[model samples]
Target chain A: MSVELISRDNGIVAVITGEIDHHAAAQIRTEIDFALERQTPSLLIFDMSGVTFMDSSGIGLILGRQRITESYGGAVAVKNPSPCARRIITLAGLSTLIIEGKKENKNEAR
Target chain B: MKHDNYFKITLPALSRNESFARAAVSAFAAQLDPTVDKIGDIKAAVSEAVTNCIVHAYADSPVVGVVEITAKIKDDTLYIKIRDKGCGIDDIKQAMTPLFTSKPEEERAGLGFAVMESCCDKLKVTSTPGKGTTVTLTVRLDKKELA
Candidate 1:
């Protein structure tokens, strides 16, 4: 997976792409966690627009980020996740933690 | 719905191993005409279970272990078995607790069993200390059973 970290005025935005399976989890986790710690933003938004497949590793990464951000009294949210990604997040009871944007005609394969 | 077809696969116990197993089972189960969501859930849950085995069960063991996965279709239900001959859980109750993990440094969410329970119709886990652990997962494939 590829992760792009954009530092906004208020928070850090992480744009993740590719599959979030076991192979991708290790590197993505380290990169995202490093960014979160270094930036220490009040809000962390995960742009999962490019994620095609996500298993439990993705869920763990989200929850871990939430825990880390919450320690700093910050908030975390996700934007524009694919249908399959949304379903997995919902099943993990993370819909409340992350705000999803309105669905668009993108990443329909997922 | 009355007959059962079975297949078994054994791979090295490693972190990236689960994805291959999930892909194999998903492709096999699709031949049974299960709903897309059902297939996805099964694939996800199976991946979590198998990954857990590779991560926790075989954490420090130098000796190689096998991760066994079996998929069978019987009576319109899909049965999946994942076995790992690694460090067996001493307390199954504590192991099943959500958010309880032995290794937080690994960022183990401890949601493996919870996800499996939420997705499959039935999930049974049997473990023997120092022996091994086996997880049996079953999901019905009825058209009306899926969202």
Candidate 2:
């Protein structure tokens, strides 16, 4: 998967696309970490709407990012995860990290 | 009862193939006309097992070994076997334990087997310490749809 960094209000948004497996996780981790380390923002958002597939490797990626952000007193959240990624995320018990993705959709519909 | 299908693939246990292995199995399982959630579950389980081979099975070895994936469908249950001829697990119980990763340095959460077990109906692991490991995942399909 590839990550595109965008500067949101106070947090940085990482729009990730493609499949995330062991190989792709490493790359996505590196890219996100590089950005996180560079900016050291207080908040980071992961946009995974374009991710076609994800397994535990994706879980590891999110967990690692959470660990990193915690170390620096920053927060990380997930947004717009695809159906597959959402299932994996919830199964991994990181449903707390999900935000805006589900809630925002409801708001927009209303 | 006409859902009888079988296929096997052997490829080097490279991290890159994790995607192929899982996707191939998902595509094959799709013949069951399972829900998207079911497809996601199968793919996640397949990936966890395949990742084990790429990251641990062939680890610390001079050569990248091969991981064999054999899939069969019968009675509407999908059975998959991911086999690798590399360093095997000494303690199956310990390896299957959640948050019990052998490679913590690589940011492994040790939740591979946990994810596999959660996603599939049954998980079986057989291994010989010095020989290799074989992980079997079984998923019972839902012939009906609810979405």
Candidate 3:
């Protein structure tokens, strides 16, 4: 998997791509965590549009990040998840954690 | 008792091979002409089973264990069995409970068995401590209805 970090004034957007099974979760987690540590944005937006596949491991990755970011007084948001990815996330009872990105207001952080 | 087609593969219980196992099983199920959603379901279920082996089965040992996967197709049904020779579960009942993970520190949701049970038509798990664990999943293909 590949994670591209976009730094904005409001928060950091992580655009992740490729399959996110157990094989790729560790690397993706490390990359995202490194970016989070460096940026320390108020909000972390995960652009999952490019993600083709995800499983429970992906859930764990998100939860892990949420815990870390929340500990530092930040929030996590998932944007534009695929149908399959959405299913897994919802089944894991994480639907409330996702926030749709605003298309009209690109500068908005939350 | 009979299958028109069958395939078997044995791979080391490594986290890196989880995707490989999922892809192999999905490709094998493709012959049954299942829908994309059905295939996704199968992939999700297989991934959970394999992840369980990699995480829980070999939790203690430095030496990696072996995971065996078998697929069989009969008529419009697909059967998959994932077996692991590692530290087996002491309690199958508690293990199958949703949100019951032994490794909570790893951020495991403990929904592995729940996901597999929801995705497949039938799910069966059998394990013996100091022996091994086998998870059998059966899914009915919707090809006939779609055809």
Candidate 4:
């Protein structure tokens, strides 16, 4: 899986595409973390509308990002998760972090 | 009696192989005519099992170990066995507990077995310390409905 960062409202929206397993988590984590360290946005949004598949590793990815972002007084939100992804996230007890998929202009990051 | 329809594959216990292993099994499971949702469940569980093999089982070892996956159809049940030759769990019960991960520092949510259990009809794990681990996941795909 790959993450494309979109800057909006003083935050970063990471649009993830492809299946996220333990294998793909490494690269995806690094890219997002790098953006966090550089931009240090006030919010981190995981737009999973393109995520066709994700397991526990995906949960871990989000949790880890939350931990990092929290230390910097930042926030995280998951947008438009697939049914399977929503089920696993809810099972992991992170459903509260999800946001409705609505009203976002696609502003590509620099 | 054992079902004659089955397939086995052996691959290096690498993280990248997780996707490959799950896809292979899903393809084989097509014979059961399972719904896309059921197939999604099977794929997620398979990914978790294979990840454990790569992360926990072969975590310390520099040598790339092997993961064996076998899928079989018996009656309406789909049986999947994911075996790994690595440092097996010392306590299977503890390992299966939700939010219990040996590699917590690595951000492992420790929900592998929990996810597997929720997705499958039956979840069984057997491990031998320093030997290996075999995770058996069974899903009932009401093939009768399709028939």
Candidate 5:
């Protein structure tokens, strides 16, 4: 998985690529947390346009980040999650946390 | 009735292998000519089952544990079984409960079984505390219309 942090005037946008599974959650959490710490942006946007698949572990990663951001008076938002990923996030009761961003038409085949 | 096709694989209960298991099962299910949504559902169910084995089943082991996955197609239904020989669950009911993870520190959402249940037609879990745990998932493939 690859996470690229872009500094915006409002907040930081993290563009994440690849699958978010148990194996990739730790690294993702660490990277995003580091970015959050350094940037300390009021908002953290996760761009999941390149993400192919995600499971419950992805929920844990997001919740963990949410805890960190909330502690510092910052908020988290998810952007452009694939249909499959969106379903998992919704099932975990986290769809409300997602801020609808760019919509992608990619089919989740994997 | 006997299965028309069957596949089995044994892998170490490691976090990295979770994706491999999911991919393997999804590839096998492709024979049913399912849609992308159906394939996604199968992958999601398999991922949850395998993740449970890696996280909960082998929670405290210095050595790597083994997880066995078996997929079979019978008629229009696909059957998947994931077995782990590590630390078995004490209470199957409690374990299957939504948001009932033993390791809260790990940030576990505890929605593994719930996701599996939602994605598949049937989910059956059987375990013995000292023995092992087996999760069987049954998914029905809808007949595709000819173009």
Candidate 6:
């Protein structure tokens, strides 16, 4: 699986493309973390539209990213998650932190 | 019951090894056309087992370890075993608890075991404190059980 980063002034968007199974977890984690740390955006959006596969490790990646973003008083959002990816995210009960939409929910950070 | 076509792969005990494990099992399970949900579950179980090996088993040590994965077709069922000879769990019960993670700093949801349990027909975990942990999962083929 491959991950691409698009940094914006408002937030840094991570476009994760490929199968996010156990194998891709570590590298994805490292790249995302580095991007988040370097950009330090108030919001981090993960675009999973291109993700064809995902598992529990993907859930961990979301949780880990959320924790890191929240630590800096920032928030994380997941946008356009594929059907399969959404199922796993919802199964993990992480919908509270990660949302689906175009406009950002600014209130969630508080 | 005598069966044929079994495969075993030993992956490096690293965080990146999960993909290999998942692919190996997915290839084996493809004959069943397991639903997307079932495939996801299988991958999840594999992830939990591998993650445990990477984060907890080999904790801080650079010593390379091995995660042995075995897949066998028996009696219309696919059994997958993931074994890691790293730091063994002291308390299986506590370790299996939902959201009970040894490392909170890593932002672990601690739902690995729960996810694995949800994904497979049967999930069994056997661990020796100093020896290692073995996670055995059985997924009954869809047709035979359905019929």
Please give each candidate's TM-score.
0.86, 0.90, 0.93, 0.95, 0.93, 0.84
How would you encode candidate 1's per-residue C-alpha lDDT over B1-147 as one tens digit per residue? Answer: 256788999999876676788889888888678877888888888887888788878877897688999999887788999998989999999988877788777777777788788889999999998878999999888865555
DockQ-based ranking, best first?
4, 5, 3, 2, 1, 6
lDDT for each residue of candidate 2 in B1-147, tens digit (9 for 90 to 100): 264789999998888788888889989998888887888889889989999998998898898899999999997899999999999999999999888889877878788999899899999999998899999999999896565
Tell me the tens digit of each residue's lDDT in model 4 across A53-98: 9899999999999999999899899998878888889999999999
TM-score of 2: 0.90
Report every candidate's CA lDDT. Answer: 0.82, 0.86, 0.88, 0.89, 0.87, 0.79
Report the CAPRI category for model 6.
Answer: acceptable
lDDT of 6: 0.79
True contacts kept of each: 0.50, 0.63, 0.71, 0.87, 0.82, 0.61
Best model number under TM-score = 4
Candidate 3 lDDT for residue B51: 96
- Candidate 1 lDDT (Cα, 0 to 1): 0.82
What DockQ does each prediction reach against the true complex?
0.52, 0.60, 0.73, 0.87, 0.75, 0.48
TM-score of chain B of each: 0.93, 0.96, 0.95, 0.93, 0.95, 0.90
Tens-digit lDDT track for model 5 on B19-124? Answer: 8999999999998998888899999899999999989888887888999999999998999999998788898899889888898789888899999999999999
Q: Interface root-mean-square deviation for each candidate? A: 1.7, 1.3, 1.1, 0.7, 0.8, 2.3
Higher-lDDT candidate among 5 and 6? 5
Better of 3 and 6 by TM-score: 3
User: Against the true structure, whose DockQ is highest?
Assistant: 4
Across B68-113, the per-residue lDDT of candidate 4 in tens digits comes to 9999888778899999889989988888889999997777899999
Per-residue lDDT, model 6, residue B147, is: 44
Write model 1 residue lDDT over A1-110, tens digit each, in one string. Answer: 68877776778777888778766788887887898878788998888888877776788888788899999899889888877678778877788766666533323322
DockQ of 2: 0.60
Between which residue pairs do clashes occur in model 5? none
Local accuracy of candidate 2 as per-residue lDDT tens digits, A1-110: 67777875567788888888888989888888898888888988888888988877788888888888889899989997888888878877889988864423212221
